[model samples]
Target: MKRPFFVVIVTVLLFIFACNQSVKVEVVTESSMRDSTQLVFWKNLGDLYGKAFRGTVVAGGDGDTTFAGELVMHVRLVEEGVIKVPFIVGRDSSRTWIFTLESDGLMLNHDHRHPDGTESESNMYGGKTTNFGTAECQVFPVDQATVNILPTRTTNVWWVELVPGSHFTYNLRRVNTDRFFSVRFDLTQEIETPGVPWGW
Candidate 1:
């Protein structure tokens, strides 16, 4: 009888914990602060328009050795709440990161290009902010186009973070699979910009 009672108590505790988690998930603080925060942040990058930043992979794993080389982010265009930043990886200048203003959130799109200015076989996939994330950080779950392009990446997510006067980070994670990649850029120092990216 005591053994049965112990099992019942364990089950009740688990149910209560699950309920609390569910409530927390359903209720996240959605405030207007995110807009003001992102706006200020966007202006900060816009202030650096046309300037290219050079940094290194800093850290990553899982077949991402190619990404461990010198990294580049060219803030090529900024206009009317839209910023077009390209990430030139090592000798590969085929990736452009598009960030646009959404009424409700920010949008992140990976613009992959070829040497001839043509779109890659797998390109134009990313995500948009889904919540009122803090100004210093925001998360974007994989978009539908991304999942459709690479079904295996259905669980992928990407985010960019900026800590004023410190560092900027580009991160990717394949949730539920333990695959992760992160590249940190030193914001304190700006390096020389590379030549125009291919097809730019």
Candidate 2:
């Protein structure tokens, strides 16, 4: 009789413990900043104004390895119609980034990889990048909310000027081992609306 009672007590305790177990759920925050149509316009503009730029990299080391590479950037309209750009840096050594403006804050996100096979990210004031790939990526603020450019590593203040109805010149530069290199990423496409609409 005592053995039967002990088994019953153990079964009841196990049932209670199982009943008290908690279930966890994940939550993701969605931006209420841009509406669907506007966001679509921005994405489309990014696709339209997207361009791929190629250049020669010259760096210093025991033995210099020269590489010719290309980068593709898709520019979208942001908060105040300022451009929000998402870009991929390379085919061999690549990093993807979402570039945007927040209030008075200029943010650059570097979603790169680590040697230990992990995802790594760097946040910058205007632009943030790491020297992981023998090259660095960056962005600069030109106006209060417009015409930013990512010049070469050595460019102190290279900027692009855009006058809506007229023509605009986008200037970019890169430097390796004190050698200033330059490349012009032409505006290959333009979209006044979002090209690829996603997100809630």
Q: Which candidate number maximizes lDDT?
A: 1
- Per-residue CA lDDT of model 1 for 1-200, tens digit only, reads 36688898999999999888844344333444764576666767677787776666654655656775678787888999688888887788898888887778888888888898899988878988787566677788988878888999898888888777677788888899877888777777777878788778
**lDDT by residue (tens digit), candidate 2, 1-200:** 36798898999999999999996866432333233322343344344344333322222222433324443444433445355444433443333334453443334443444434355442221332221111112234333222233333323333232322232233333323353333333443332332232210
Best by the TM-score measure = 1
Q: Model 2, residue 154: what's the lDDT? A: 28
Residue pair clashes in candidate 1? none
List the candidates' TM-scores in order: 0.78, 0.33
lDDT of each: 0.78, 0.37
Candidate 2, after superposition: displacement of residue 7 in Å?
Answer: 99
- Candidate 2 has an lDDT of 0.37
